[model samples]
Every structure is written in C-alpha cells, then in structure tokens.
Target: MTSVVITGKRYLTKPEEAEKFGPFERTYLAEGDSWMDSSAWNQGSLPEFLVRGFNRRGRSRLIVNISTSGHTLTKIVDMMNDELVWWLNQGTYDALLFSAGGNDFIDAARDAPPGQGLLFDMRGKPMPANGYDCVNPAALQRLVDYLNVNFAAIYQAVRSSGKNAATPIYLNAYDTPQARDAPAIRDLAGPWLYTAYTKNGIDPALWDQLTAGIFKDILHTITAWADGRSGVHVVPTSDLLDKAVPGSTGDSKDWVNEIHPNKSGWKKQVEAWLPLLS
Candidate 1:
C-alpha cells in the first residue's frame, strides 16, 4: 500500500499536504527538482506549514500529488490520465488526502462581465456592468450541477477500480472568505469585492446576494452533498474561525483568497482530516 495526496487546484499548492504526516517508511511520489526551493515557501505565497499529520503518525510517507490549477474533475482526469491509470493498477496508495470543488465555484461565478455586480475575484480581467439580469443564475446553477455530477462520477470511478473501495475520502469545504475578511472590508481602499464589482456599476442587493448568500451557499451545498456519500466525509475549513474573532486584524492574513488557504490556514484544515487519514 502507498500514501497518496490526490487533490486539485489550491489544495495541492504544495506537497506539504502529503509530507507533513511522514517518517517515510516508504514514500512514493517524485519530488520536484527544486522541491526544497519552491517559490510557494515565500510569504504571500502558500504558507510553509505541515500538510495534515504532524504529531500523529510518522511512517514512510509517499505523497503523490495530482493537483492542477483551475481544474475540474474533467480537466484533472484528462491531465492525470496516465498517472492515475498507473497508480490504480500498481495499487500504490493506502492513505489518501483528496480536496477539490473551488474551481467549480470559481467557474460558475466567472461569467459575470467585468465591473458589473460584486466581483469576488482578484484575477486581472476586464470589468463590465451587465444589469441584474445580466448574470445568468440558472446557467450558473446548471454549471454547479454538472460539476457535482462529475465529482460523483470521479468518486465512483476511483471506488470501482482496483483500489480499495472503502478507502476514506474527505470532502473539504471552504469558509466564507468575504465574511471572514470583514475587517479588510472596513479598512481597504474600496469595499474590496463590493467596490471592485460596482467599480463599474451593480445593484446593492445584488452585491449582498453575491458575497454573503450565493458564495457561502455554494460551498455549504457542496460539502453537505458530498457528506451523504457512504465512504466520504466532510471537513470544513471554517473551523479555524473559532479562534478568529469577529473584528480581528489577522483575518486578511489568514486567507490567500476566498477559497485557497494560506499555510497556517491549510494547517488548520488538515487537522480536521487527521482522524479520517488512514
């Protein structure tokens, strides 16, 4: 059996997710040539924290990272097809750390024309204000549904393969970054997301719906749905907020963005997965 880190997008920002739980009885994945000198170690980049296990199990750890930026299940399968096939037949994974779904949310919300409505993104794309009806809510919902279907399909594929069908899978849910970063909203030059979206023009109600309602609900639903599966568990990233007071200065520093976690943030999330880690 092998230890593996199966993830996508922000989840696999680094190998620490798989290595933190190790003493390397027999680690598997290959390390990047400049692994020790990767840029993610820099501040403002991913934090230099443990992946998941720290004071728990210290054995031969093999981390096989199958993470990709902006990847959906369809995209990840295409990119890692050969690697996944080999890993499946080789039966090299015993413990697994799986995280995903952020890109699906990002894609659903990205269709908004630049500058119109509440812009919750930092990507340097052009902004435009299309009217309240300008955003297609139904299409977005359909996109989300499609994403969930793909997620289920991927999970089924993994379970039906030569690998252990009962191998525990953890579904990670993101916290409300906007709500979590409220202090930044109060101090930042503009209303952060709100100002950015209406920098062009958008309705106040629409902004609230986008930031407080839709964004949070998307994450909640994904986790709730994933949890219903027999062999899957939900691990929420918001548990750290237990320590982050409502009006604290450190909130901004806690997040890399609305979804991705900083090193310390990721550490907190990984903690929730420890019991599930086989």
Candidate 2:
C-alpha cells in the first residue's frame, strides 16, 4: 500500500464553511460515509485494506481519514482551503480516495410532502400524493449543475496541489441503496425516501424505482464528469450492495444504515477497487 493521510473537511452552508475534522493532519485524507465509513461500521475502508495488503512489507503509510456522515458536495468543496493546499504542498501523497454527492439529493428526497417542499414533477403539476404544488424536479437539476462544476473543481484542485501533482485520485460510485428506510427523524441518516413516497402519494410499487432512479441520476452525472480525467478513476459497487436481504432490519448484508456499507459491504468494495489501485 502507498503512504498517505486521511483528513476530513466539509461545507454545510450556502457560502460553505470549511471545517477540519481534527487538529492534526496526515498523508492519507478521506471524506464521505458508510463506504468511507463511521464508528458504527467499525470495519476498515478500501484504502486501509490496500495498505495492509501492500505497505505492510515496508514502512507503514500515513493516513488521515476525515470522513463525516451524510457528506454533501457542498461540504467537500468548502474544505479546500489554504491549510489543505499548504499541506499538499508540503507532503508526499500517493493517492486520494473520495466518495460524495449522494447525500445532496438524499437530503432533498425526504419530507417533500406532495403539497410541500418538492410537490411536483418537471411538468409543473402537483405530484400524486400528500399534496400539490410546482414541480421541484428543478431541485435535482440545479444540484446536477452545482456538482458538475464543483466535482471538477475538487479534482483540479487536487491535481494542482503542491506535492499532490500527478498523484492518483480514486472516487467511489456506491451501489444503489435499498432506497427505503423505516422513516426516521430529520438529519439522521435513516429512511427518508420511503417516507417521501408514502407521504407523496406515489404508488408503492414505484417507490423502489423512484428512490433508485434519483440515486442513479445523480451518480450518472457524477460519473460523466469523472469519466476520462487524467488520473482519476470512479469505482462502481451498486450491484454488490444494492439488494434486499432484510433481517432484524429490513436491509441487506451490504448495508448497515441508509447509505453506509457494513464490513462485508466494504470488503466487496475493496475487491472491486484493489485491482484499480494495483
């Protein structure tokens, strides 16, 4: 495995404020969720696994993992500041792995009461349920536009960074989630799409596709932007984790929460991504 630090930074507001995950910095920096991971999963990530497999034979890699739960593109771009740029200029890094943007729309999909937040489809007509109003499809469109530019901006910033020039960059495209949760509270990463559908008057049968469709749409937009960048690679894992294997929870082995993968799920991700890094 290559030497690196994983530090997390995020932007949550409109003017977007960049906040460091911690006080210290390392060589390998990480951002994003369950896949990138949280305390609950308590497993390892692709980057960690990669190092254990390869870097163990020699000097250990310096890693900085600063991922936050429910990270959005807005939060990521805001984190690019003089501090990180200075660190990049000073350090020697082999690669940077990134996963983001799902939380953007995942945040939008919930509580869109048919007559409320996102009440209509693109046609400017009221949605079938919960209520009615102008179509909020524009919400997704606007997000697409924002991410298209920002994703590239983040990539370019990494490429132009001091010691990071020519460094390989890896991005993960998560497998589509079950897209349905038991509808928890706001701000918590549980179920929102299921609540949206049940509340929006959408047909129950269409719920799964509806949720998956939004995820796919945003993911496609993200992939298109990353398709042929110089050293950037997007790893896809939807098929591995996007199945229905409910237990005490109505989810799969691949997932622990709404968007994060469990240990088995991360292993699957590593399997797909190791070859790319090698």
lDDT of 1 by residue, 1-278 (tens): 22433232223476466556554554222111111112333222111232235334543445454443345555655544565444555554554344455545444454356623223332353333432333445655666677677677656756776754655555555555542233222343212343344443444435534554554655675676555677766665554632333333344455543334455665665565555443
Model 1's C-alpha root-mean-square deviation from the true structure amounts to 8.3
Best by lDDT: 2
Clashes of each: 13, 27
> Lowest lDDT 10-mer window, candidate 1?
29-38
TM-score of 2: 0.72
What would you estimate as the lDDT of candidate 1? 0.45
User: What are the Cα lDDT values of the candidates?
Assistant: 0.45, 0.58
Give stretches of model 2 more than 4 Å off.
1-27, 41-62, 111-137, 182-188, 246-251
Query: Residue by residue across 1-278, what tens digits does model 2's lDDT show?
Result: 24433343322121122123222223455555545643333444655654554454443445556566556777767766734454466566667767777776665655554645543432343344422222366676776888788788887887888678887777877776654563222434566555565565565555555656676776687678767788877777657764545322443566655555655776677777656655
